[model samples]
Target: MVWSALGILLSFALVTAVHCIFSIQMPSSLETVNGSCILIPCGFTIPQSLKESLKLPVSGIWRNGSRWFTGSTDIYNSSRKLNEIQGELLGDLLQKNCTSVLYNMGSKYSGTYYFRIETGFKYTFETPVQINVVDILPQPILSHARVSVKESTEVELTCTAPVPCPQQPPNLTWTPELGSITETLQTDETGSYTLSSVLRFVSSRSHHGESIKCLLQTQQHHSVSDHPCAITVLYAPKTQIEVNVSDPLYEGSNVTIFCSADANPEVTQIRWFREWRGNVSEINRTDLTFTMTKDRVGFYYCEAENIYGKQNSSKVSLNITEHSSEDGYDTLREGNSSTVKWLLGCCGAVLMLIILLTITLCFKRSRTRSMQGSNVNKSQIYVNFDKNFSNLQRESRDSECGVYSNVSNSQSKPASEAIYENSSI
Candidate 1:
């Protein structure tokens, strides 16, 4: 029974030894940044008899999708391996310790790595190790070059990322979507890279929403990283203006003048001035309305501006007229002048009529006197034959003649005077 117990104890110890040989512990899973170095901690426990004769596997050998070996493959090489397959490796593996290191780790190195230890008893134990490689470079960030700029102005763009792989600095390049890229530059110090690019080209409204990108490429493995920056082209503010003046404004009356302009990107400032005077005043509001004087008669204009640029509108003039005292004064002056002309014409016409009536009365009086003298001569010859009889007849006739002459004279005088007076007046 004691011999049986010894055999059973030996078998139990062998199984325990085999289990411990395959159960190798690594320093937690190794983690490293890409293009950097990482040391994979691997140590094993094996039965003393097998440890003396067992050979360590070559560094950097592929096993189950992982580069499993004593050390990293990128910097290490053994005479037996191809040049392309050689990688970095640490110092010689410890025979009794069964531990090794790896260096120059990269993203491709991330995976489960395993190694097999062959024993003289025909038993092979396989141990597994895990590794994780991380990209240390931060995600690319991009920003607008400027809010606004003038045409043909130079534009600047910036791209940044957390520096990764100090030993292998990255190269920077810029690609433009609409305009041509004039320059690309990178600033690197202590393993970090800040890439900047400038594009000097004419700008237009068509390029308002265009894009540009900055790309970073690692020297090793040609790994590519990129960030995009937008271009915002600045331009002069566009302005259109209208001018107006108050109507019915007299020469000396105060009148209001107005100036207005339309512009894009919102005009930051507006200035008002008269051409006659250098600058009347500057107005904060786009539309300016102010009481104007005759001095403001010259051309007036306005200026519109923003962060980008400035523009001015065409000048306008303000005209004023003099006011009259009363509405009827203008009309009355014209009426009085016309009345004076009419009175003078009427007086001349009356004088001409009086002269004509006097000439007609003289002609009639001379003709009547000649006719009376002829009648007196004929009667005197007849009266000489009978003196007494003639004398009596002549007296009677004279009395009748006197009565008739008086009546005729009175009627003719009143009628002639009445006609003359009516025409003169």
Candidate 2:
């Protein structure tokens, strides 16, 4: 009890030195992660006349704005409990310290806060402290002057990404490869930056179904892209169809009519029609497998469709004959049939070559991937030119593996003798 009385006298003596002026020390700003606690490093000097005794103890309050202190919005107070707020003063006022702690930081906790101290001798209000709470940013926005255009026409598309902090702006990216890119920046009243990119390009039929995307990237390496905005390039189909029928189309002979279309946005549907007596009827279950009959011979055309509209192919007529030369139907419309046959055969050969190349590429890629998955730190193997592939003894760090390699050295052997240089594994 004597020690307590001595402490009280010491506090009273300290309170005798305080003046009207107080200095508040706070960092320029502070950043806090969501769902965490933050320490607002604060220090003050109140003329060293601060006495925090039980009879007339010094009290402090933290506010979220520059409003006058009335305890209505005090986040750190002992008597105000109208609402639940997790904060407290963690510094000794007698020692000229006013640091505080805030728990469970969230978006609502972000703002400029001021500290006010009320003592028996005097009161002082500190400068505001700014706080920023970070979370996943909002998605970028995409806009365009025109989303659809005709072939060779000009159009402009714009993408905007909002950066809540003027000091840190998000990176923006575009897709589908456009031309004449322009950038602009704007700041809102709240001192946030918004970056925009404009892509000026000429639309082509090839870009009908293509999409342009805008990606926003943050310093944390997190990225989000705008929803795909498909460009609708309008144009005619420029359609053409092939009628694959026997040259003669003789009675009782099989014939096939194959139709192909090329258009912007890729013909949504194909319609086959047989026109007779100036009237048209849709042909279903039609291909190159139909038997040539009187009813089957006529002018057939195909129509292709898309968002813009539909286009009709040139009509192709097939005349069925009762007789056929032993060599089959005539080659063409009075053209050489052998040349047509040669052209078709050449196309078939080229298609086969393409298929072979694709298979080889696929196999090579697969083999490379498999080799990458192997553990090659340590291995044991035996090589013998005369040994079979399966008989080779191989060991790996992970498991036993057998490598089959065929190496031939022609210079060291006769033409009839195949010499193995490093083929055995």
Candidate 3:
């Protein structure tokens, strides 16, 4: 400790020999992130009177607050133990650079600071430097803890984070990813800045019982996060009723129909309904079943009701007939029942048209063949008559057998000679 005091004495003696040529450069203000390190850039010039003091040792010190010359308190000194302080003089005193570094900066290290230079017996203090140390980055706060809405309905949520400075504005983000965000800046009477992000989204049944979180970060990277809130999306009751029946459904047979619904907030009431003979009857239960008979041949359905609304399952008819082997009445399936009759009528019309065309073709073909048969019969009869007439003429000429024989010998001449004789005649 004595040696350190002697070093301070010599440092002041050397500065006393120097005239005023001193110049120091430092930033007016600086920002520091919590739990990080920062460098305070500083440079200084020595006086021309310190020529002989050049061989002397120079000492640099940084003290807390702006009152360094009045011995405010040493935060960093060349002669001080490093374990006693959280700052260091990084620049070399011989080069007139008084740059220093501060580690583990927090709110306690905030406010103005100054640098002091001691050369021999002379000491001088520089101007004050201000530092703004951000201790904690605020987390995002949501306006609503839990939000509930119906399907296809538009809902809104607001998330906000405090901003210490307008320059370093905090950013807000939301979970369950969404688009088309509406952002704004809000300030209250407290003079503190707040960054607000509005989320306008359409809630569906699929998003029920999910979490929505708002993340707040000072920067894009190395960001901080906040807690999450749950979402409860309400929707209309999803009614689905099942009617279980065994085969051979006849009179005085017991049947059970179970009705259920899936919905948020659960169903408050389940209603069973039966429609027969233009009369509507309501039965307040999960199932509506009675003695199956011809009188009970009608439509029945189940309805579920909640705070949101009500929904009904498809109707089932309880029909009893001699050929009705299965519990026959099921809802108009796939909307086919509404159009089946029209489709069948169209098919029957097309089939009748095709049959008429086929009959017409058969009639025309039969008529044509009958006319051809008549002509063929006429030609055959004429041929038969000509052959019979020739036979009769041959039999009648039998009495002139001798003359006939002579005429036959004359007519039996060579075909070419006969043709030549005929040509001459």
Candidate 4:
């Protein structure tokens, strides 16, 4: 009997040791914005003796103050219908999960609080949780890839806001509506929740030097925004040329040509070219504007270049008219006079070209006909020589064979008569 009593005593001492090792698992401190809600994640383990003797309808209690039951105020109680603070316990105490939540938090609720579990035997956790409440919510963090990128490159930007209360996460939005946006809720190493929004798009030259921002709206309808992020885009130059002239392009008229370019970086160099008589040559002037002389009349264009690339502007025509000393030329020498002279000169040059082409064609045709006639005459002479040679050979053969021919001249006879009369036999 004594051995049995000693064994029971040893078992009781073992149960007490097990209970001393396990207390509670929870964060020591938490923070939240005023007029918002906060969630406290908590769990605890009880001793084997308490678990074996545990009763139904367990109670979870939270007290605010230095002492537990003496001077502390009951903020939340699972057993009672009414409490000081409006909250709900989300975890099941039977399963050792003690997670809870508090709503409509304010500076008055910022203090140390303790948790107690009543399961047949009342036990209070000595570890206390500290709550910090602030009047203003901090701004969300914004991040992105490289600020300066080439055109058509894919870009992604992210905006993250803290989620103090998982049930009520803050809404995130991007400024100017950049592109497709995706949202996700994530957890950090400290077990805090964060809501993030990612914006993705293809960059373009039009988006250069644009300010982008992220806005956040809290559960209490409080709005805040982060600093703007400025982007820089790099692209090739787009060049344009403009001409300034007050009067017609006469022989001594003054003309000014201007060149401009649009690019991410300023244009580093500009070049001018003149095309005349099917030949293109570079002009020595390099400034944005230059004066032209009569000798420079032709098709003019400018090329602008930057670090990325270069571009050429459309060509502009510059026509100069030669001044005539006649009275009529002086009377119509202003605006329409130079244009009329240019058109007349072009028409006369075209007419002269047509006349020269017609003369050349006639000379080639005459030379070709003369060569054909000469060839026909030479062919007839060779045929006559062949006929004469054949007649002489037939006469010599007749004389050697002592045969007399009735035809004296075979060359004068018809082809059929020659064949019959010139026979040797």
Candidate 5:
């Protein structure tokens, strides 16, 4: 009896080890993102011989910590939690394989989960699965400079956000239509990202009530956050102001002095003042056209202001000279003399240039002729040497004939006399 019991015990131990080795394996240790779903994939293999004999129910129970409760029986029966876990089970228990998917994962669902399998033979096996839950919140801020600007001017807007490392970054978007959108940028400091978008449009009365918004959407589901900021635009108009008057005004002559200004919104007011005469006048229009006298000659200026800004013209010196008939005639004669002098100077410069060019050409021609003469002299020297060589050749021929005649006379006196007589004849 003792021997039989030992054999049975050894057989049971071996069977248990084999079952454990073939148990289901979950690909990813459980992980969850806030407001997102988590999928737990389980895979297992059964021995071919026992495939038909062994009946493994696909039902599983998830427990947090040491609590052992059935997911289908306990949670499904409870009215409050039934809707939550029932959807997650999704008919995953009936299948032979131990694979499951959880949806609408919440922070409270974060913990360890255990699976329980029941065989037809009253044998039961259990395995543990661990899970981690993370929280990802959207935090975005806007930063920019504050300044006053006139109407129809442009402004800039910037947006920034933070990102967590080892976690997916969120998507950033801008609203209330501004300018072109910029690309996303990452920083060296962990868990941080920044983005800037420009808003360029003419500021007007309509824009005073408008606001710019920056939206951040976290990757964990569609959780979103928004940041909004306001803008104030100021307008003023005042550019340049100036004073002008016609020249030559007699003591009692009707002289007109005008004040003019340039502005975008159009100058609303123009005031004229004389420092020496202490005369002040308010010109409602842009141009101040009035009669002037010798008293209005010392110094004159104008001030211009508008909704945009304000400006003042520089003090202008106005001289009222005595009017005379010779004054007009003398001015014309002086203008004529100045023109004549300018013409004479221009003509003299042209004549000087022509004379210089003529001199340069004449010098180049003389140099070329001198070089030709030198080449001719070298050719003449070669001709003289050829004539001298011909004269020397004639002298040598005469010497050779004298020696031949002397040799013939010495050899035979009669023959020599005959040869000499025949030659002479």
Candidate 6:
């Protein structure tokens, strides 16, 4: 049983010694701005045999070459010694944390580097990290929440930049500062820290077609900007109508109307509309200009349309009147005077005819009365003559009778009889 236990322990020790070795876990490549600092995130594992021999006051060293035996090119060291690249070791070496920072870096410090530890012994990691230095910081990447933006809607945009030096992270700024800006730190798939600036605001028509850019400010005060991105906004059209004349529209006069519109993507079609006697109708015109006639006497308006929407202009009214010539006033006055003279002549002729008719009727009435009076006088004279003749005859016969009676009676009547006889003789 004792020999079996010894063989089991030996097998376990061989496996541990073969698998456990000095190793490091960190980023393979990194980039930083000129004259700025760089952050190196590191964690390491020591051999299992050396874990028992670890002691206090551990020393961390970083060299600027692939192999440590090439030369004594130590850029950073935890021991008290002047370093070529100024930096600090933030991680605890006892806890196997080797996170560090390098300051005042330049192109001279750009290369592969290795990490080593010393505690009465020495161990170096086989894996190395590459550092790339640049004169100007790289431009930030800009992304939108949506591809198409609409007017008067809430929108968000993100501007991202790599944080090579987390201690002195780069700041992002937007041109025109259109909205509220907020910043946050995020880790990518490669385990690298990045900074993002989020902008939120409501879009407007005025912002359409405007260019926006994101600028990155590094710790070294170097400013870099991305390409300008234009904003496309979808909105309705604004319409207005213009005319050649402002007032005093006349019949038989030529008038022209113009339609103007301000919109995105341009106006597609324009139409003319008219309202007369409470009825609306469309004029058969599709172009910008419309011709007005005397019969088109009412309210007029125009409609402008595009792919987004349509808009109608304000209503304009027109009143048509008879046209009079300013230069022909004297000729018209002369013509009116002649017409008045002809009318007066006709009225005078009619008055003379009425007076003649009244005079003829008076003469006929006087002649009829005079003829009737003369006839009445002739009839009276005839009646008086017949009566007088009869009386004379009767008196003669009576005288003859009286003479005969006197003669026979022979008295005083004898003289009368004798006179009558003498007359006979």
- Pick by lDDT: which candidate is best? 4
Judged by whole-model lDDT over C-alpha atoms, candidate 2 comes out at: 0.68
Q: Kindly give the stretch of ten consecutive residues in candidate 4 with the minimal lDDT sum.
A: 402-411
lDDT at 151, model 6 = 73
Per-residue lDDT for 1-425 in model 5, tens only? 99999999999989876864545565335555666555555544554454564544434444455335443222221113544454344333334455555555678777766545445422222455676667755446666434345667776666665433213445667667656666456543221234434445667644554666766665544333354666566544333434444455556555445556655456787776666656555445444455666545666667877876777677767676777889889998899999999999999999999999999999999999999999899888877777677656745764777577557655767876867754753
After superposing candidate 6, which stretches have Cα over 4 Å from the reference?
1-19, 144-147, 188-191, 219-226, 287-294, 320-425
Model 3 scores what on Cα lDDT?
0.73
Winner on lDDT between 3 and 4 is: 4
lDDT of 2 by residue, 165-279 (tens): 4334557788876778888888654333578888888987778878788777755644455477788887857678776666756888776777776677677777788887788
Model 3: residue 269 alpha-carbon error in angstroms: 2.7
Candidate 1 on 1-425: residue-level lDDT in tens?
99999999999998877855535555445555676654444455566655554555533232434334444332333323554323333334344233334445667768776644333433323555566778753344555543466566655554554333323445555565444554333433221234444444566755665666656555443323343445565566666556555566555445444544443456787777666556465445545566666655766677878776788877666776666666578789889999999999999999999999999999999999999999898898777657877667867875879677556656778878756743543
Off by over 4 Å in 2: 1-131, 144-153, 164-168, 178-180, 188-191, 209-211, 225-227, 246-252, 260-425
| Per-residue accuracy of model 3 over 217-330 as CA lDDT, tens digit each | 654223433557678888889998777765667666777778889988889999888888889898766556666777666788888889989999988877664654242443
TM-score each candidate: 0.30, 0.37, 0.43, 0.66, 0.29, 0.66
Q: Candidate 4's C-alpha lDDT?
A: 0.82
Give a tens-digit lDDT track for model 4, residues 271-344.
99999999999988885344557677789999999999999999999887655677465666675778998999
Instruction: List the candidate 3 regions with Cα displacement exceeding 4 Å.
Output: 1-32, 35-64, 67-136, 148-153, 163-171, 184-193, 218-227, 233-236, 247-254, 263-266, 284-286, 289-291, 320-425
- Residue pairs with backbone atoms closer than 3 Å in model 6 (clashes): none
Candidate 3: C-alpha RMSD after superposition: 16.2
RMSD of each: 28.6, 32.7, 16.2, 21.4, 20.5, 29.3
True-structure lDDT of candidate 6: 0.81
Which residues of candidate 5, in runs, are more than 4 Å off? 1-232, 235-239, 244-268, 278-286, 305-311, 323-425
| Clash counts for all predictions | 16, 5, 14, 0, 7, 0
